[model samples]
Target: MSTSDPRPALFDQWLPAEYRRRGDFTVLVVLVGIDTRSIELLSSTFMNVIGDETRWREVRQLFQSSETDWNGAAFFPVDSVIGPVPNDMARTQLRALEEKVRADRRVLNGGHFFDRKGRRLKVEEIVH
Candidate 1:
Protein backbone atom coordinates (compact mmCIF):
# COMPACT_ATOMS: atom_id res chain seq x y z
CA MET A 1 0.00 0.00 0.00
CA SER A 2 1.08 3.52 -0.62
CA THR A 3 1.67 6.13 2.01
CA SER A 4 -1.87 7.37 1.45
CA ASP A 5 -3.58 4.07 2.18
CA PRO A 6 -6.55 4.70 4.41
CA ARG A 7 -6.31 1.26 5.91
CA PRO A 8 -3.41 2.40 8.06
CA ALA A 9 -5.80 4.58 9.97
CA LEU A 10 -7.16 1.44 11.55
CA PHE A 11 -3.71 0.78 12.99
CA ASP A 12 -4.33 2.91 15.99
CA GLN A 13 -7.84 2.63 17.24
CA TRP A 14 -6.92 3.81 20.70
CA LEU A 15 -3.27 4.52 21.45
CA PRO A 16 -3.06 6.02 24.85
CA ALA A 17 -0.88 9.09 25.30
CA GLU A 18 0.81 7.44 28.24
CA TYR A 19 2.06 4.63 26.04
CA ARG A 20 3.46 6.94 23.42
CA ARG A 21 5.03 9.05 26.12
CA ARG A 22 7.03 6.02 27.09
CA GLY A 23 8.12 5.69 23.45
CA ASP A 24 5.52 3.03 22.79
CA PHE A 25 4.07 2.83 19.33
CA THR A 26 0.85 1.09 18.39
CA VAL A 27 1.03 -1.20 15.38
CA LEU A 28 -1.16 -3.46 13.29
CA VAL A 29 0.03 -6.64 11.62
CA VAL A 30 -2.33 -8.80 9.58
CA LEU A 31 -1.92 -12.50 9.02
CA VAL A 32 -4.29 -14.68 7.04
CA GLY A 33 -5.05 -18.43 6.80
CA ILE A 34 -4.09 -19.07 10.39
CA ASP A 35 -6.53 -20.64 12.79
CA THR A 36 -7.37 -18.88 16.02
CA ARG A 37 -5.37 -21.43 17.97
CA SER A 38 -2.22 -20.69 16.03
CA ILE A 39 -2.80 -17.01 16.44
CA GLU A 40 -3.02 -17.42 20.19
CA LEU A 41 0.18 -19.42 20.26
CA LEU A 42 2.08 -17.13 17.95
CA SER A 43 3.72 -15.23 20.78
CA SER A 44 5.20 -18.33 22.30
CA THR A 45 6.50 -19.49 18.97
CA PHE A 46 8.05 -16.13 18.33
CA MET A 47 9.77 -16.02 21.67
CA ASN A 48 11.05 -19.53 21.25
CA VAL A 49 12.86 -18.62 18.08
CA ILE A 50 14.24 -15.27 19.21
CA GLY A 51 15.00 -16.11 22.83
CA ASP A 52 14.30 -12.58 23.86
CA GLU A 53 11.00 -12.73 25.63
CA THR A 54 11.87 -9.64 27.56
CA ARG A 55 11.99 -7.52 24.44
CA TRP A 56 9.13 -9.42 22.92
CA ARG A 57 7.10 -9.34 26.09
CA GLU A 58 7.44 -5.62 26.39
CA VAL A 59 5.56 -5.33 23.13
CA ARG A 60 3.36 -8.37 23.53
CA GLN A 61 1.70 -7.11 26.65
CA LEU A 62 -0.25 -4.51 24.71
CA PHE A 63 -1.52 -6.91 22.09
CA GLN A 64 -5.13 -6.74 21.00
CA SER A 65 -6.06 -9.56 18.71
CA SER A 66 -9.18 -10.51 16.78
CA GLU A 67 -10.19 -12.65 13.88
CA THR A 68 -12.20 -11.85 10.78
CA ASP A 69 -14.42 -14.30 8.93
CA TRP A 70 -14.56 -13.48 5.27
CA ASN A 71 -15.85 -15.96 2.71
CA GLY A 72 -15.49 -18.77 5.21
CA ALA A 73 -11.78 -18.12 5.74
CA ALA A 74 -10.13 -16.67 8.80
CA PHE A 75 -7.93 -13.60 9.04
CA PHE A 76 -6.04 -12.50 12.09
CA PRO A 77 -6.17 -8.88 13.06
CA VAL A 78 -3.37 -8.45 15.56
CA ASP A 79 -2.20 -5.19 16.98
CA SER A 80 -0.21 -3.96 19.93
CA VAL A 81 0.18 -0.72 21.77
CA ILE A 82 3.68 -1.46 23.00
CA GLY A 83 6.86 -0.02 21.64
CA PRO A 84 9.54 2.55 22.16
CA VAL A 85 11.60 -0.12 20.50
CA PRO A 86 14.53 1.45 18.83
CA ASN A 87 14.65 1.54 15.03
CA ASP A 88 11.40 -0.30 14.32
CA MET A 89 12.43 -3.33 16.30
CA ALA A 90 8.89 -4.63 16.65
CA ARG A 91 8.33 -4.51 12.93
CA THR A 92 11.49 -6.47 12.37
CA GLN A 93 10.46 -9.15 14.83
CA LEU A 94 6.98 -9.33 13.34
CA ARG A 95 8.30 -9.71 9.83
CA ALA A 96 10.66 -12.46 10.93
CA LEU A 97 7.81 -14.33 12.56
CA GLU A 98 5.58 -13.87 9.55
CA GLU A 99 8.12 -15.33 7.16
CA LYS A 100 9.17 -18.15 9.46
CA VAL A 101 5.61 -19.32 10.05
CA ARG A 102 4.65 -19.16 6.39
CA ALA A 103 7.80 -20.87 5.21
CA ASP A 104 6.49 -24.37 5.88
CA ARG A 105 3.15 -23.57 4.25
CA ARG A 106 1.44 -24.93 7.29
CA VAL A 107 -1.38 -23.28 9.21
CA LEU A 108 -0.23 -19.78 8.33
CA ASN A 109 0.20 -19.82 4.59
CA GLY A 110 0.10 -16.16 3.81
CA GLY A 111 -0.42 -12.70 5.21
CA HIS A 112 0.60 -9.07 5.06
CA PHE A 113 2.28 -6.79 7.58
CA PHE A 114 1.62 -3.11 7.87
CA ASP A 115 3.26 -0.24 9.66
CA ARG A 116 1.55 1.89 12.27
CA LYS A 117 0.23 4.18 9.57
CA GLY A 118 -1.71 1.34 7.93
CA ARG A 119 0.66 1.37 4.97
CA ARG A 120 1.10 -2.14 3.65
CA LEU A 121 4.72 -3.21 3.44
CA LYS A 122 6.24 -6.11 1.61
CA VAL A 123 8.04 -8.72 3.66
CA GLU A 124 11.27 -7.60 2.05
CA GLU A 125 10.68 -4.14 3.37
CA ILE A 126 11.34 -5.34 6.86
CA VAL A 127 13.41 -8.45 6.20
CA HIS A 128 16.41 -6.60 4.88
Candidate 2:
Protein backbone atom coordinates (compact mmCIF):
# COMPACT_ATOMS: atom_id res chain seq x y z
CA MET A 1 0.00 0.00 0.00
CA SER A 2 3.03 2.33 -0.06
CA THR A 3 2.46 3.24 -3.68
CA SER A 4 0.07 5.91 -4.91
CA ASP A 5 -2.51 3.25 -5.76
CA PRO A 6 -4.68 1.96 -2.94
CA ARG A 7 -6.86 -0.46 -4.91
CA PRO A 8 -4.70 -3.44 -4.02
CA ALA A 9 -4.86 -2.73 -0.32
CA LEU A 10 -8.59 -2.12 -0.52
CA PHE A 11 -9.08 -5.53 -2.11
CA ASP A 12 -7.04 -7.11 0.64
CA GLN A 13 -9.43 -5.56 3.13
CA TRP A 14 -12.56 -6.83 1.36
CA LEU A 15 -11.79 -10.53 1.21
CA PRO A 16 -13.93 -13.04 3.10
CA ALA A 17 -13.21 -13.54 6.79
CA GLU A 18 -12.13 -17.15 6.51
CA TYR A 19 -9.01 -16.40 4.44
CA ARG A 20 -7.80 -13.44 6.48
CA ARG A 21 -7.38 -15.07 9.91
CA ARG A 22 -5.28 -17.73 8.19
CA GLY A 23 -3.05 -15.28 6.24
CA ASP A 24 -3.89 -16.38 2.69
CA PHE A 25 -3.11 -13.79 0.03
CA THR A 26 -4.59 -12.99 -3.42
CA VAL A 27 -3.55 -10.60 -6.16
CA LEU A 28 -4.52 -9.70 -9.70
CA VAL A 29 -2.22 -8.89 -12.64
CA VAL A 30 -3.53 -6.78 -15.46
CA LEU A 31 -1.69 -6.06 -18.72
CA VAL A 32 -2.21 -2.51 -19.88
CA GLY A 33 -0.72 -1.21 -23.12
CA ILE A 34 -1.75 0.58 -26.26
CA ASP A 35 -4.49 -1.83 -27.38
CA THR A 36 -4.73 -4.87 -25.16
CA ARG A 37 -5.80 -5.45 -21.61
CA SER A 38 -5.74 -8.92 -20.09
CA ILE A 39 -6.00 -10.15 -16.53
CA GLU A 40 -3.74 -12.68 -14.87
CA LEU A 41 -4.36 -13.76 -11.30
CA LEU A 42 -1.77 -14.96 -8.82
CA SER A 43 -2.15 -16.49 -5.39
CA SER A 44 -0.41 -18.76 -2.94
CA THR A 45 -1.63 -22.34 -2.83
CA PHE A 46 -3.80 -22.63 0.26
CA MET A 47 -1.37 -25.06 1.89
CA ASN A 48 1.85 -23.27 0.93
CA VAL A 49 1.67 -20.32 3.36
CA ILE A 50 -1.15 -21.20 5.71
CA GLY A 51 0.31 -22.28 9.04
CA ASP A 52 -2.39 -24.88 9.60
CA GLU A 53 -2.69 -26.88 6.45
CA THR A 54 -4.80 -29.50 8.12
CA ARG A 55 -7.26 -26.99 9.47
CA TRP A 56 -7.33 -25.16 6.18
CA ARG A 57 -8.13 -28.35 4.35
CA GLU A 58 -10.82 -29.10 6.85
CA VAL A 59 -12.41 -25.71 6.32
CA ARG A 60 -12.29 -26.18 2.58
CA GLN A 61 -13.96 -29.49 3.11
CA LEU A 62 -16.64 -27.96 5.31
CA PHE A 63 -17.39 -25.10 2.96
CA GLN A 64 -16.96 -27.28 -0.12
CA SER A 65 -15.50 -24.07 -1.57
CA SER A 66 -13.34 -21.06 -0.72
CA GLU A 67 -16.46 -18.97 -0.41
CA THR A 68 -15.65 -18.50 3.25
CA ASP A 69 -11.86 -17.94 3.23
CA TRP A 70 -10.87 -14.53 4.55
CA ASN A 71 -7.38 -14.15 3.13
CA GLY A 72 -6.17 -10.64 2.29
CA ALA A 73 -6.17 -10.06 -1.49
CA ALA A 74 -4.95 -7.29 -3.80
CA PHE A 75 -5.42 -5.93 -7.32
CA PHE A 76 -2.83 -5.31 -10.09
CA PRO A 77 -2.24 -3.49 -13.36
CA VAL A 78 -2.29 -0.37 -11.27
CA ASP A 79 -2.93 1.52 -14.52
CA SER A 80 -5.82 1.22 -16.99
CA VAL A 81 -8.06 3.18 -14.67
CA ILE A 82 -11.11 2.17 -16.75
CA GLY A 83 -12.77 -1.02 -17.95
CA PRO A 84 -12.39 -3.24 -21.04
CA VAL A 85 -9.33 -1.49 -22.39
CA PRO A 86 -8.32 -2.24 -25.99
CA ASN A 87 -6.73 -5.65 -26.53
CA ASP A 88 -3.64 -4.34 -28.30
CA MET A 89 -3.04 -1.88 -25.51
CA ALA A 90 -3.41 -4.72 -23.09
CA ARG A 91 -0.78 -6.70 -24.96
CA THR A 92 1.61 -3.81 -24.89
CA GLN A 93 0.95 -3.40 -21.22
CA LEU A 94 1.66 -7.06 -20.68
CA ARG A 95 4.96 -6.76 -22.52
CA ALA A 96 5.92 -3.91 -20.26
CA LEU A 97 4.96 -6.04 -17.29
CA GLU A 98 7.09 -8.89 -18.59
CA GLU A 99 10.06 -6.63 -18.83
CA LYS A 100 9.49 -5.40 -15.30
CA VAL A 101 9.13 -8.91 -13.95
CA ARG A 102 12.34 -9.87 -15.70
CA ALA A 103 14.01 -6.94 -13.98
CA ASP A 104 12.85 -8.41 -10.65
CA ARG A 105 10.05 -6.01 -10.12
CA ARG A 106 7.38 -6.63 -7.47
CA VAL A 107 4.50 -6.24 -9.86
CA LEU A 108 2.71 -9.55 -9.75
CA ASN A 109 1.99 -11.54 -6.58
CA GLY A 110 -0.76 -13.17 -4.47
CA GLY A 111 -3.82 -15.34 -5.20
CA HIS A 112 -7.03 -14.63 -7.07
CA PHE A 113 -10.76 -15.41 -6.65
CA PHE A 114 -13.12 -17.29 -8.90
CA ASP A 115 -16.87 -17.62 -9.40
CA ARG A 116 -18.39 -20.23 -7.19
CA LYS A 117 -22.00 -21.17 -6.47
CA GLY A 118 -23.13 -17.98 -8.24
CA ARG A 119 -20.57 -15.58 -6.84
CA ARG A 120 -18.46 -13.73 -9.38
CA LEU A 121 -14.90 -12.80 -8.43
CA LYS A 122 -12.29 -10.79 -10.29
CA VAL A 123 -8.54 -11.01 -9.94
CA GLU A 124 -8.18 -7.27 -9.40
CA GLU A 125 -11.04 -4.96 -8.56
CA ILE A 126 -10.35 -1.70 -10.40
CA VAL A 127 -10.93 1.40 -8.32
CA HIS A 128 -11.04 4.96 -9.61
Candidate 3:
Protein backbone atom coordinates (compact mmCIF):
# COMPACT_ATOMS: atom_id res chain seq x y z
CA MET A 1 0.00 0.00 0.00
CA SER A 2 1.04 3.57 -0.66
CA THR A 3 1.13 6.57 1.65
CA SER A 4 -2.51 7.32 0.88
CA ASP A 5 -3.72 3.78 1.28
CA PRO A 6 -7.09 3.83 2.99
CA ARG A 7 -6.01 1.48 5.72
CA PRO A 8 -5.43 3.26 9.03
CA ALA A 9 -1.71 3.45 9.72
CA LEU A 10 -0.42 1.72 12.80
CA PHE A 11 -1.81 3.63 15.75
CA ASP A 12 0.73 5.39 17.93
CA GLN A 13 -1.35 6.40 20.90
CA TRP A 14 -2.87 3.70 23.10
CA LEU A 15 -5.77 5.92 24.07
CA PRO A 16 -8.47 3.98 25.84
CA ALA A 17 -10.94 1.91 23.80
CA GLU A 18 -14.56 2.16 24.90
CA TYR A 19 -18.21 1.34 24.14
CA ARG A 20 -21.66 2.60 24.95
CA ARG A 21 -22.84 1.19 28.23
CA ARG A 22 -26.44 2.33 28.51
CA GLY A 23 -29.02 3.49 25.97
CA ASP A 24 -29.13 2.54 22.29
CA PHE A 25 -27.43 5.71 21.09
CA THR A 26 -23.72 5.88 20.25
CA VAL A 27 -20.88 8.36 20.24
CA LEU A 28 -18.41 8.29 17.37
CA VAL A 29 -14.80 9.31 16.98
CA VAL A 30 -14.04 10.95 13.63
CA LEU A 31 -12.45 13.86 11.77
CA VAL A 32 -14.28 16.79 10.20
CA GLY A 33 -13.09 16.62 6.59
CA ILE A 34 -13.08 12.86 6.21
CA ASP A 35 -16.06 10.83 5.15
CA THR A 36 -17.97 9.34 8.09
CA ARG A 37 -18.05 5.96 6.33
CA SER A 38 -14.27 5.90 6.11
CA ILE A 39 -14.07 6.63 9.79
CA GLU A 40 -16.59 3.89 10.41
CA LEU A 41 -14.29 1.38 8.71
CA LEU A 42 -11.89 1.59 11.61
CA SER A 43 -14.20 -0.64 13.62
CA SER A 44 -12.93 -3.71 11.76
CA THR A 45 -9.37 -2.72 12.56
CA PHE A 46 -9.98 -2.51 16.32
CA MET A 47 -9.29 -6.20 16.87
CA ASN A 48 -6.04 -5.97 14.95
CA VAL A 49 -5.06 -2.78 16.65
CA ILE A 50 -6.06 -4.21 19.99
CA GLY A 51 -3.97 -7.33 19.22
CA ASP A 52 -5.77 -9.67 21.60
CA GLU A 53 -8.61 -12.06 20.93
CA THR A 54 -9.95 -12.01 24.44
CA ARG A 55 -9.76 -8.25 24.57
CA TRP A 56 -11.53 -7.80 21.28
CA ARG A 57 -14.17 -10.31 22.28
CA GLU A 58 -15.13 -8.22 25.26
CA VAL A 59 -15.11 -5.00 23.32
CA ARG A 60 -17.08 -6.72 20.56
CA GLN A 61 -19.79 -7.69 22.99
CA LEU A 62 -20.38 -4.06 23.95
CA PHE A 63 -21.28 -3.18 20.39
CA GLN A 64 -22.85 -6.40 19.16
CA SER A 65 -25.99 -5.83 21.20
CA SER A 66 -26.66 -2.48 19.62
CA GLU A 67 -27.83 -1.56 16.14
CA THR A 68 -24.42 -0.17 15.44
CA ASP A 69 -22.23 -0.34 12.40
CA TRP A 70 -19.55 -0.87 15.01
CA ASN A 71 -19.20 2.84 14.62
CA GLY A 72 -21.39 3.92 17.46
CA ALA A 73 -18.76 4.58 20.11
CA ALA A 74 -15.13 4.17 21.07
CA PHE A 75 -13.39 0.80 21.65
CA PHE A 76 -11.39 0.14 24.78
CA PRO A 77 -9.34 -2.82 25.86
CA VAL A 78 -11.49 -5.36 27.66
CA ASP A 79 -9.17 -5.97 30.58
CA SER A 80 -8.14 -2.46 31.50
CA VAL A 81 -9.34 1.06 30.84
CA ILE A 82 -12.20 -0.53 28.92
CA GLY A 83 -15.41 1.36 29.50
CA PRO A 84 -17.24 4.55 28.70
CA VAL A 85 -15.20 7.73 28.33
CA PRO A 86 -16.75 10.45 30.44
CA ASN A 87 -18.83 12.58 28.06
CA ASP A 88 -17.36 15.90 29.16
CA MET A 89 -13.81 14.70 28.65
CA ALA A 90 -14.74 13.02 25.40
CA ARG A 91 -16.06 16.32 24.08
CA THR A 92 -12.98 18.19 25.24
CA GLN A 93 -10.63 15.67 23.70
CA LEU A 94 -12.32 15.99 20.32
CA ARG A 95 -12.22 19.77 20.43
CA ALA A 96 -8.46 19.93 20.13
CA LEU A 97 -7.84 16.58 18.46
CA GLU A 98 -7.80 17.78 14.88
CA GLU A 99 -4.94 20.13 15.50
CA LYS A 100 -3.30 17.59 17.76
CA VAL A 101 -3.26 14.95 15.01
CA ARG A 102 -2.11 17.35 12.31
CA ALA A 103 0.90 18.41 14.33
CA ASP A 104 1.67 14.79 15.15
CA ARG A 105 0.43 13.17 11.91
CA ARG A 106 -1.57 10.48 13.62
CA VAL A 107 -4.43 8.64 11.89
CA LEU A 108 -6.70 9.49 14.82
CA ASN A 109 -10.25 10.56 14.02
CA GLY A 110 -13.79 10.12 15.33
CA GLY A 111 -16.82 12.04 16.59
CA HIS A 112 -18.22 12.70 20.02
CA PHE A 113 -21.91 12.95 19.36
CA PHE A 114 -24.70 14.60 21.38
CA ASP A 115 -28.22 15.66 20.69
CA ARG A 116 -29.26 18.92 19.03
CA LYS A 117 -31.22 19.89 22.13
CA GLY A 118 -28.08 20.52 24.12
CA ARG A 119 -28.59 17.38 26.14
CA ARG A 120 -26.86 14.03 25.95
CA LEU A 121 -27.81 12.12 22.80
CA LYS A 122 -30.41 9.39 22.89
CA VAL A 123 -30.50 6.05 21.06
CA GLU A 124 -32.76 7.23 18.27
CA GLU A 125 -30.42 10.03 17.27
CA ILE A 126 -27.43 7.77 17.55
CA VAL A 127 -28.54 4.67 15.65
CA HIS A 128 -30.68 6.23 12.97
Candidate 4:
Protein backbone atom coordinates (compact mmCIF):
# COMPACT_ATOMS: atom_id res chain seq x y z
CA MET A 1 0.00 0.00 0.00
CA SER A 2 1.24 3.48 -0.84
CA THR A 3 1.72 5.79 2.11
CA SER A 4 -0.95 8.18 0.79
CA ASP A 5 -3.47 5.64 -0.39
CA PRO A 6 -6.97 6.42 0.82
CA ARG A 7 -7.91 2.91 1.88
CA PRO A 8 -7.70 2.57 5.63
CA ALA A 9 -4.30 1.34 6.81
CA LEU A 10 -5.87 -0.52 9.67
CA PHE A 11 -7.41 -2.95 7.25
CA ASP A 12 -4.02 -3.71 5.76
CA GLN A 13 -2.73 -4.55 9.16
CA TRP A 14 -5.70 -6.54 10.43
CA LEU A 15 -7.62 -8.06 7.56
CA PRO A 16 -7.80 -11.83 7.45
CA ALA A 17 -5.32 -13.70 5.27
CA GLU A 18 -7.85 -14.62 2.60
CA TYR A 19 -8.98 -11.06 1.99
CA ARG A 20 -5.52 -9.56 2.47
CA ARG A 21 -4.14 -11.67 -0.33
CA ARG A 22 -6.94 -10.51 -2.62
CA GLY A 23 -6.15 -6.85 -1.78
CA ASP A 24 -9.72 -5.52 -1.40
CA PHE A 25 -13.22 -6.46 -0.28
CA THR A 26 -16.61 -4.82 -0.10
CA VAL A 27 -18.30 -3.73 3.10
CA LEU A 28 -21.81 -2.32 3.11
CA VAL A 29 -22.83 0.27 5.66
CA VAL A 30 -25.96 2.23 6.45
CA LEU A 31 -25.91 5.74 7.82
CA VAL A 32 -28.93 7.29 9.46
CA GLY A 33 -29.97 10.77 10.46
CA ILE A 34 -31.86 11.50 13.64
CA ASP A 35 -33.85 14.39 15.00
CA THR A 36 -36.35 14.78 17.81
CA ARG A 37 -39.09 13.16 15.75
CA SER A 38 -37.59 10.59 13.44
CA ILE A 39 -34.63 8.44 12.50
CA GLU A 40 -34.28 8.28 8.74
CA LEU A 41 -31.95 6.25 6.60
CA LEU A 42 -29.36 8.58 5.18
CA SER A 43 -27.20 6.44 2.90
CA SER A 44 -25.91 2.98 2.21
CA THR A 45 -22.77 1.98 0.34
CA PHE A 46 -19.59 0.02 0.11
CA MET A 47 -17.67 2.99 1.43
CA ASN A 48 -14.53 1.05 2.19
CA VAL A 49 -13.94 0.52 -1.50
CA ILE A 50 -13.63 4.21 -2.27
CA GLY A 51 -10.02 5.05 -3.14
CA ASP A 52 -10.32 8.67 -4.17
CA GLU A 53 -8.48 10.71 -1.58
CA THR A 54 -10.70 13.77 -1.69
CA ARG A 55 -13.91 11.80 -1.48
CA TRP A 56 -12.48 9.53 1.19
CA ARG A 57 -11.42 12.54 3.21
CA GLU A 58 -14.87 14.02 2.96
CA VAL A 59 -16.41 10.77 4.17
CA ARG A 60 -13.87 10.50 7.00
CA GLN A 61 -14.69 14.01 8.11
CA LEU A 62 -18.38 13.21 8.14
CA PHE A 63 -17.84 9.97 10.03
CA GLN A 64 -15.63 11.62 12.66
CA SER A 65 -17.37 14.94 13.08
CA SER A 66 -20.54 14.48 15.04
CA GLU A 67 -21.97 17.92 14.28
CA THR A 68 -21.74 17.64 10.50
CA ASP A 69 -25.09 18.00 8.80
CA TRP A 70 -26.50 16.64 5.57
CA ASN A 71 -29.59 18.37 4.23
CA GLY A 72 -30.35 19.83 7.66
CA ALA A 73 -29.90 16.50 9.35
CA ALA A 74 -27.11 15.15 11.53
CA PHE A 75 -26.21 11.71 10.29
CA PHE A 76 -24.68 8.82 12.16
CA PRO A 77 -24.09 5.14 11.70
CA VAL A 78 -26.92 2.78 12.41
CA ASP A 79 -26.57 -0.86 13.54
CA SER A 80 -26.15 -2.19 10.03
CA VAL A 81 -22.59 -2.86 8.87
CA ILE A 82 -22.28 -5.83 6.60
CA GLY A 83 -19.33 -7.61 5.02
CA PRO A 84 -16.02 -7.89 4.02
CA VAL A 85 -18.32 -9.92 1.85
CA PRO A 86 -17.17 -11.07 -1.60
CA ASN A 87 -17.86 -8.66 -4.47
CA ASP A 88 -20.76 -10.62 -5.98
CA MET A 89 -22.31 -11.24 -2.59
CA ALA A 90 -22.02 -7.58 -1.64
CA ARG A 91 -24.04 -6.62 -4.71
CA THR A 92 -26.76 -9.13 -3.84
CA GLN A 93 -26.92 -7.85 -0.28
CA LEU A 94 -26.96 -4.23 -1.37
CA ARG A 95 -29.81 -4.88 -3.77
CA ALA A 96 -31.88 -6.60 -1.11
CA LEU A 97 -31.30 -3.82 1.38
CA GLU A 98 -32.15 -1.15 -1.19
CA GLU A 99 -35.43 -2.90 -1.88
CA LYS A 100 -36.33 -3.02 1.80
CA VAL A 101 -35.45 0.63 2.28
CA ARG A 102 -37.48 1.65 -0.73
CA ALA A 103 -40.47 -0.32 0.47
CA ASP A 104 -40.24 1.29 3.89
CA ARG A 105 -39.78 4.76 2.37
CA ARG A 106 -36.80 5.18 4.67
CA VAL A 107 -34.04 6.46 2.41
CA LEU A 108 -33.36 10.14 3.00
CA ASN A 109 -30.16 11.15 1.22
CA GLY A 110 -28.86 9.04 -1.64
CA GLY A 111 -25.58 7.07 -1.30
CA HIS A 112 -22.29 6.32 -2.96
CA PHE A 113 -21.45 2.88 -4.19
CA PHE A 114 -18.18 1.52 -5.51
CA ASP A 115 -16.68 -1.60 -7.00
CA ARG A 116 -13.63 -3.36 -5.56
CA LYS A 117 -11.40 -1.18 -7.70
CA GLY A 118 -13.02 1.97 -6.28
CA ARG A 119 -14.94 2.80 -9.41
CA ARG A 120 -18.23 4.56 -8.62
CA LEU A 121 -21.35 2.74 -9.75
CA LYS A 122 -25.05 3.22 -10.00
CA VAL A 123 -27.33 0.95 -7.99
CA GLU A 124 -28.78 -0.40 -11.19
CA GLU A 125 -25.30 -1.07 -12.53
CA ILE A 126 -24.36 -3.05 -9.49
CA VAL A 127 -27.56 -4.92 -8.74
CA HIS A 128 -28.27 -6.33 -12.18
Q: Tell me, by TM-score, which candidate is best.
A: 4
The weakest ten consecutive residues by lDDT in model 2 span 43-52
Q: After superposition, how far is residue 94 of candidate 3 from its true place, in Å?
A: 3.6
lDDT of 2 by residue, 21-100 (tens): 43543222332211123342322221122222333234335334544343322223223334335556655655565565
Q: Of 2 and 4, which scores higher on TM-score?
A: 4
* Candidate 1 structure quality by residue, lDDT tens digits, 89-112: 556766665566556433332333
**C-alpha lDDT (0 to 100) for residue 91 of candidate 3:** 54
Please, what are the lDDT tens digits per residue for candidate 4 over residues 28-106?
A: 5554444545445566555344222234334545554654343222111222244245556666776677566556533
Candidate achieving the largest lDDT: 4
Q: Cα miss at 88, model 1 (Å)?
A: 3.3
Ten-residue stretch with the least lDDT total in model 1: 44-53
The better candidate by TM-score, 2 or 3, is 2
User: Pairing residues by index, what is the TM-score of model 3?
Assistant: 0.27
| TM-score against truth, every candidate | 0.24, 0.29, 0.27, 0.33
lDDT ranking, high to low: 4, 2, 1, 3
RMSD of each: 15.1, 15.5, 14.0, 14.0
Residues 49-107, candidate 3: write the lDDT tens digits.
Answer: 22222333444364555444433333222222534355555555444553454554223
